[model samples]
Target chain A: MTPSTDSPPRIYTAALAIIGNEILSGRTQDANLNHLAKTLNGWGVEMREARVVPDIESEIVAAINALRARYDYVFTTGGIGPTHDDITADSIAKAFGLPLVEHPAAIALLEHYYPPGELTVVRRRMARVPEGADLIENPISKAPGFKIENVFVLAGVPSIMRAQLQGARAFIAGGRSVLSRTVSVLVGESKIAELLETAQGQFPDVDMGSYPFFKRNALGTALVLRGREEARLEAAYDVLVGALSAAGIEGHPGELPD
Target chain B: MTPSTDSPPRIYTAALAIIGNEILSGRTQDANLNHLAKTLNGWGVEMREARVVPDIESEIVAAINALRARYDYVFTTGGIGPTHDDITADSIAKAFGLPLVEHPAAIALLEHYYPPGELTVVRRRMARVPEGADLIENPISKAPGFKIENVFVLAGVPSIMRAQLQGARAFIAGGRSVLSRTVSVLVGESKIAELLETAQGQFPDVDMGSYPFFKRNALGTALVLRGREEARLEAAYDVLVGALSAAGIEGHPGELPD
Candidate 1:
């Protein structure tokens, strides 16, 4: 939602659509989601949701359409390669009801990257893009990713996708960045659930979470408080630490070392 | 859709709903999706889609409702702990339009696990589930997960979730297992796209995928063929290897050593 002229800054949101059968089939572990989430967070864009869909055209189209409608921006990874299973570009075109065509810039890039007479028909498939789309630079490889409206299509390879994301930084409009603080204690989550509930009630604006961890066979819980306002986050952290101390538990300032 | 009594076995499909803020915030990398996908696949259930949603109640309920309607079985992990941020139980109840009530078996489990007078009200929160739900056993910890209709709820921690999933095995009905074979060629995907395409056309029953990788500074692609019938999958693999050999590239039998 847009903010009023005198209101506070509006928070930007994004969603990721991972289009690959390898991920859904357990053949390949997805490495792009965490990197994308952290990168977007640093730019003040919150990644609100993500979906891993197979290479099926209908599934990819539906996921792209659903995410683009709800989030400020939608990004998709995978299905843009030259192989037969790489159907991301065509699926995205279908999702937007547009025709797929060869982009002149993409073709020129591919032609220049490959040796003379080596850019075969199948290799040139990477030059195809949805009509009326802008190309996102791929530094690692000659083939470029494309952007159409609110959806940004990226490669599935982690290194190439990270490079294209950097090129996409110019297109994203960021808002106020959310900051967080963490406190860890050598106690299980259930041991401090009531205190955490009370602290959460006291600071309703700050989003709090408790994650249980096992360190050297000792059970512990990490309490994290996140908010856009630094002052509010600090206050909440202090209150949480004070409550833990009152209950005769030592709350470390940060997460325990592994 | 069900198969005829005399027809071949039907392939069962499942969808996962991962509920957590840590995953979306980039604080935690998800470790459950791949494990669940592999486990379900081994049991002859294909993981068709997965969604990572925040801990918001509305989002959780919406994701659950959407996934459950489309897949044969739906699984959810995270947000079932005792902390205030844990709201999966309530959201699931809302999704099914059922009342949230304390399960007697769950209470007994928790009471038996914790020390005397330690199972406080907040600790007892884990015992609450949707009305008319069956309990899923937790081997590591005493807090039990629950199953309501087609949806199975598990914990966020990897070890605990894996244990709970083993307990859920009895409730699932599996189909024919999908088998796969991989051949790695020391060439980029673009170099062999046409050959792979032709091979895929020859064996339409097998699901083919090409994944490019860079190992030891050498570019290569892994060609994978999957199908329910072992003979068909092997034939596809043979065709792929033959195509690569005709193209003057050696095809390794399996994935490249890491």
Candidate 2:
């Protein structure tokens, strides 16, 4: 299905910043961003941009300055750890010119997990929060996340991060999540080029893409169709499928096009 | 691996930015960071920070300004699509105070993909290059990527971005990679918390983590151990494993404790 000239068009926006040395060292694979994107999509929030920076203070500060000013809500993961490298709170504070002080609420939580004086230099790192920032609670762990302005600074550890965000969810913006559909075809992407061109022209409001993959040694293509308007997207998707059927290509009816 | 106490540890760095309005709109899930991280880890480069931005010019410029000055390399993906929202090229050029030029190499590659002038205003968006940047060749599509000072501009599509990266690998730094190991334990993370704490104390050089996961619907913990000093790390791992084995903990004989 495709959108006609009479239909209203669609758009989305998002900003993602991943903070971790483990990810950069090629030591670990990060599955969080993609997961976040999918979840946001379900809620109709667009993830507009993503950035990755290191564990350095200056670097993190600079990145915070850059993203906070550009995005509706800047989401950062990875550096809110109980270690020396966990400098996100201080960084965000520095970016906003706020004072980073040990918050009474966070200190209470810290004491629950760590006995007095057990929270060493590294562990104490997790308790510091900037002035005027609200706490994003962590049900799994005692240390809470903070939301200053619109930047939601969460823990880098997945479980802790998820719990904190769960507590912070309602305050975030909700949008009309656009619809998506997929059309798979056995024809080579090169062969399906003309049809893709036609589909795109026929439905300018919808985004149509041809992803070619190799399965069992033969070239296969998956055409992904997406749009904000449901009826228009459905229309363009149907037309794309019809064109694929006419071309004698066969695949699934509705898997992700990519 | 653990770092030798005597040797000063130096951390490698990187920055990532995802550019696209679709991502913001929750229309598409991004798989590039994980894939790219896998590649980066092979070379031991650490991804310090990441951000996602919408298809806005000033936003991209602002991000570029902050990241370029702080990290060894800044990577940007997406927004090079053949659509009105694809304004990455011009913004990148503008960010560096460089003039936008019809890059000869990129134009030639585009010509090879679709005949000269067959590219409309939308498609031509992929061909814009900032002055003084080297083109990064796209293996999936003919359109190439370009590199400015400390910045590698690649495609938004995963396959195309990956192919372009393969073409850009030679430009990475030549630092020796950080090494790590993983040991699985058939026990809950809480049960092993004491041992983990003890082991970390004994092997201060190793960074230890306990990751819990479900196998056959049963909970198990995987200890990921990382560091720079090979011998010290190996020795610590052995001692840590020995202690666990003595305590009836099932673990690898030589898998260093993380």
Candidate 1 has a TM-score of: 0.97
List DockQ, one per candidate, in order.
0.86, 0.25
Stretches of candidate 2 exceeding 4 Å from the true structure: A1-19, A26-28, A38-167, A172-258, B1-12, B112-125, B138-141, B188-206, B242-248, B253-258
What is the C-alpha lDDT profile of model 2 across A141-252, one tens digit per residue?
Answer: 5658888898888866676777877776765776667678877667555556766778889998787765555566655766778778888888898888788789876757
Instruction: Indicate the DockQ of the complex predicted as candidate 1.
Output: 0.86
The digit string of per-residue lDDT tens for model 1 on A1-258 reads: 332235777899999999999999999999899999999999999999999999999999899999999999999999899999999999999999999999999989988988899988998888888999999987666667899999999999999999999888888999978899999999999888989889999998799999999997899999999998788889899999999999988998888988
**Candidate 1 Cα errors over 4 Å, as ranges:** A1-6, B1-6
Candidate achieving the largest TM-score: 1
Angstrom error at residue A175, model 1: 0.3
For residue B201, model 1's alpha carbon misses the true position, in angstroms, by: 0.8
Residue A153 lDDT, candidate 1, scale 0-100: 95
TM-score of each: 0.97, 0.67
Number of backbone clashes in candidate 1? 0
User: How far in Å is the alpha carbon of A85 misplaced in model 1?
Assistant: 0.4
lDDT of each: 0.91, 0.71
Q: What's model 2's lDDT at A177? A: 76
